[model samples]
Target: MFAALAAVAIFTGFVDAIAGGGGLVMMPALLATGMPPHFAFGTNKLQSVFGTTISCANYTRGGLVDWKGNWPLAVLVFVASASGALVVQQVSTRILAYIIPVILLMMVAYLIFSPRMNDEDAHERLSRVGYTPVAGGIGFYDGFFGPGTGQFFTTSLVALRGNGLIRAVGNTKLLNATTNWAAVLVFALSGKMIWLLGLSMAAGAMLGGYLGSRFAMKHGARVVRPLMIVASLGLTGKLVWDWFVS
Candidate 1:
């Protein structure tokens, strides 16, 4: 069971590090262990922090990330995510269970309807004021609901800031990592994280992170778009099933 779960985690980490939906992999694997839903979610966050951290580092080393323009956004995301995670225990997952399907449907629609969006040579059109609110809001969302946060950040940076898809994805890694670490702290303090499972998954995630980042760098935005679309659709299916069947 452990070996099989680890294999799945590695694959998920790679896909997630590149495109931003590893939860699709990690969550189910953890739940398969018979952990409660809440604990599974929390533990996923813990493992994801390490995966994303490795992703961020890999992207940074590749010169795909723009840290100078993104540091402020990271700070805002950290604060907002921490606050949201702190409050997570008080909220009902049933609310998310209902809302996620709707959100996933919207994401699929956008991915399908939007004219192909690629920014090979995009110049910035957004100021800090314009982006700060968006960063903080999504950071809070990451902590509150926890799935699809990467897609949201990627789309926002691409549409609003005029970043190319690949750059946006790379930058999203850093910001998402920031939010994940913030949530991890809260989950850790609450003893909601399962270290054995999380670490086992993290090992796979780290390898996935490196491989995924490389794939993203090699292929660029055009290649990632279809993958993102597929992941989003799968996410929609998963959320809908969880909502209706659970």
Candidate 2:
């Protein structure tokens, strides 16, 4: 069981470092261990924080991240993500859940088929003020529903902010790492984490994150774009399944 968890973490960490939405992949392993859904969620957050941070660090080292200019947005993401976690308990997400897969499917199609897509920065459409809403929207979604946050951020950076795919992916890792911490702290305080296992999986994730970021840096969009499509499709499939059964 422990070996299976570690192997899955390595794979998901690789996928997550390149794309996002590894949670759907990780959850089944946690559930198979007889963990309650909420507990599995918390443990997932706990393990993911490490992998995300590693990926973010690699991106920063590669100079793909713009921390000086984007720190405020990071702070905004942290606040909004935590707020989303709090607000989720008070809301019904059935409609939102049903809608998100459609959005993801469209995003996957565009990213995969768009001839216009490239690793070149284009005309910046949004100023800092304009991007605030985007940051808050996805951050809130990250905490509220917990899937596709990285893809949402990367797409916004590319389509809305006109960032290059590689840079957008790097920045996505930074934002996601920031977003994960908010969930981690919130879930930690709830006292549900399985520390030994979480930490062990996290160790495996670090190995994957490091290797994945390196591959992305070397191959650029060639690697990231397809993996993102896979991740988005994976999330879309999960959401569609949940909507059907629920």
Candidate 3:
């Protein structure tokens, strides 16, 4: 079971490195091990954060991250996500979950149709400062509830910041990595993790993240844009299915 899951972790990290829906694969694999749902979610964070951080590092190393522009937003994202984690039990996110599929579907359509979704930077529609509120909301949503936080961040960067798909994805890794730590902290405090499995998976995820980010930098927008669309569509289906089951 551990070996199989480790392999899944590698693939999860790869996809997550590109477009941000790693949980789509990892969560189900964890659940199949027969742990409780909280354990599954917590363990997911425990393992996936490694991939997120590794992917972010590779992007930053590739000179794709705008440190001066994005650092403040990263700090805000961390705080907002932690705050959301604190309030998660107080809120019911089913309504928001229902709304997400719609948003993801819209994102998929835009990705499929948009002509400007390339690697070259374009005219900024919203300044970095103007993006704080949206970034905060995504961070909060990731901590409080999520199936598609990566896609959300990537699309926002592309559509709102007018970042090309490549840079948008690179920065999305930074924001996505920031979003994971708070949830991991909350889950650890609550004793909701499978440490042995998480650690095992983390190793695979780290390798996968490294390779995936390198691949993204090598291939650029042609690869990332379609994967973003796939991520969005996959997430939309997951959220919609969950809504129906719930």
Candidate 4:
């Protein structure tokens, strides 16, 4: 079972590194281990931390991440995510279920149809000050639901901040790492994680993350944009299904 979980983690890490729907893969796989849903969520977070950290490191070393400009956003993401987790129990997620899919579909349409959307950076629509709120809001969304946080971050950077695809992906990894670790800490404190299972999966995730990052680095926007589009569509489909089914 552990070996099988690790294998799934490898693939999840790879898809997650390139796009951002890793949870779409990892969560269902974890549930198949017969773990309780809460424990699965916690364990998934533990393994995801490893994968995201590796991807972030790879992006940083490749000079794709804007560390100096993005550190503040990372910090904000952590805090905002933590706060969102704390407040989640008090709020109904039905609103998000209805709204997020629409937004995600809009993002998909924009990415698909926008002629100017390319690998190259363009003029910025939002300044650093404007981006702070955006980062904080997305971080909160990650903590609260977290299906397509990576896609959201990448899209926002590319469309709003005028970043190239490669750079947007790098920054997305960093912010994703921050939010992931923040949620992991909360889950760890609640004693929800199965450390043995999570660590085993992490081993696989680390390797997958490294290889995926390398591929993204080599392929640039050609790979990332299409994956982003797929991920966004997938997320939208899932959200719509859940909303209708419920």
Candidate 5:
């Protein structure tokens, strides 16, 4: 079981390192191991944080990150996500259920129809005030339910900030990694995480992140779009099925 999950984690890291939906792979794999659902989610976050950190490093090394103006946004994202984690028990799953499908479907549609869109360079289109709310909201979403956080972050950077696809993805990695780390910390404090599983997944994710980032830099959005489409549809299917079954 550990070996199987570890393999999945590597692919999850690679995909996530490039485009931001690694959870679509890793979380379900963790859950399939027969752990409790909440434990699976928490442990997935624990492993994912490391993969994301590795991805962030890879992107930064590739000169894809803009840390100077982004720190404020990152800080806001971390704080808001932490707050959301604390308040998630208060939010109704019914609301999330109604909203998530729509959002996921929309993301899938965008990836399919707008193949030519996505910035090819790095430039900030949103002012600090303008982006604070966006980042905070997404961060909150990440904390509350994180399956699609990376896709949302990637889209936000592209649509709102006019970043090139590569840069947008790089920036998304940074933000998502930070949020995952915050969640890990909180979950650890609450004794909600499974360390052995997390470490195994982390190993896979790190290798995947390295390879995926390198592939993205070489291939660009032309490759990413199709994979994004597939990942989005897969996630939509999973969520819809889960929603129905649960």
Candidate 6:
């Protein structure tokens, strides 16, 4: 079971590095291990930290990440994500089940059809000061529901903040790592993680994240944009299915 979970984590890490719907793969796989939903979420977060951290490091080392400019947003994401994780322990996510699919579908449509979409950075629509709250809000969503977080972050940066696709992806990885680690800390305090399983999966995620980040860096938007669109559609389908089944 551990080996199988690790295998899935590898694939999830690869897809997640480019697109952001990695949880769509990881969560169901964890649940199949016969863990409860809360345990699955917690363990998934533990493993995801490895993958996101590797991807963020790759992006940072490659000079794609603007650490100095983005550090404040990263801090806000950590705080907001931890708060959301704590709140989620006592609340139902049923409402998000209905809402997130619509939002994801909209993202897919925007990615596919937006004429302004391009690989290069454009004129900024929102300054860093204006985008901070947006980042924090998305961080909260990640902690509470967490499906297409990478897509949301990437899209907001590109469409709103005028970042190029590659830079947007780099920043997304950093922010994701922030929220993931923060949520993991909260889950750890609550004793919700399966340590052995998470560690097993982390090994695979680390390798996959390295390879995937390298691919994204080399190929840029030619690869990332299509993957983002595909990931968005996939997430939308999964959420709609879950809504129907529930």
Per-candidate alpha-carbon RMSD to the true structure:
1.6, 1.5, 1.5, 1.6, 1.8, 0.8
| TM-score, structure 6 vs. true | 0.98
| Local accuracy by lDDT, each model | 0.83, 0.86, 0.87, 0.87, 0.81, 0.91
- Every model's TM-score: 0.93, 0.94, 0.94, 0.94, 0.93, 0.98
Q: Which ranges of candidate 5 are over 4 A from the true structure? A: 89-94, 122-125
Model 5 Cα lDDT, one tens digit per residue, 1-246: 878888998988998877767887777777777887667878988888888888889889988988887888898889877877767645554577567878989987777776434546545578768988889999988887887888888877776787778888888888998898878877777777899878987899889988998998888888877777777778778778888788
Per-residue accuracy of model 3 over 1-246 as CA lDDT, tens digit each: 888898999999999999888898888788878998777888898888999999999999999988778989999999888777767756666788788889888888888888878888889888888889999999998888767899889888988999988899989988888889878888789888889999999999998899899999999989888888887888788777887787
Backbone N/Cα/C clashes per model: 0, 0, 0, 0, 4, 0
lDDT of 6 by residue, 111-180 (tens): 9888656678898899999999899999998888788989999999999899888999999999999999
TM-score of 5: 0.93
Where in model 6 is the C-alpha error above 4 Å? none
What C-alpha lDDT, on a 0 to 100 scale, does residue 49 get in candidate 6? 93
Q: What lDDT is reached at residue 54 by model 4?
A: 99
Global fold similarity of model 4 (TM-score): 0.94
Model with the higher TM-score, candidate 1 or 3: 3
- Better TM-score candidate (2, 6): 6
Off by over 4 Å in 3: 90-92
lDDT of 4 by residue, 110-222 (tens): 88888645778899999978999999999998777778889899989998899988888998999999999998887788788899999999999988888889899999888
- What clash count does candidate 4 reach? 0
TM-score of candidate 2 relative to the true fold: 0.94
Candidate 1, residues 1-246: lDDT per residue as tens digits?
A: 667767887888888877788887678878888998778878888778888999899889988788998898899999999888877778775777677768777776766676545647465567767889989989998887787898888877877787788888889999999999999888888888888878887787888888898888888867788788888878878888887687
lDDT of 2 at 55: 93
The candidate maximizing lDDT is 6
Candidate 4 Cα lDDT to native: 0.87
Q: Judged by TM-score, which candidate is best?
A: 6
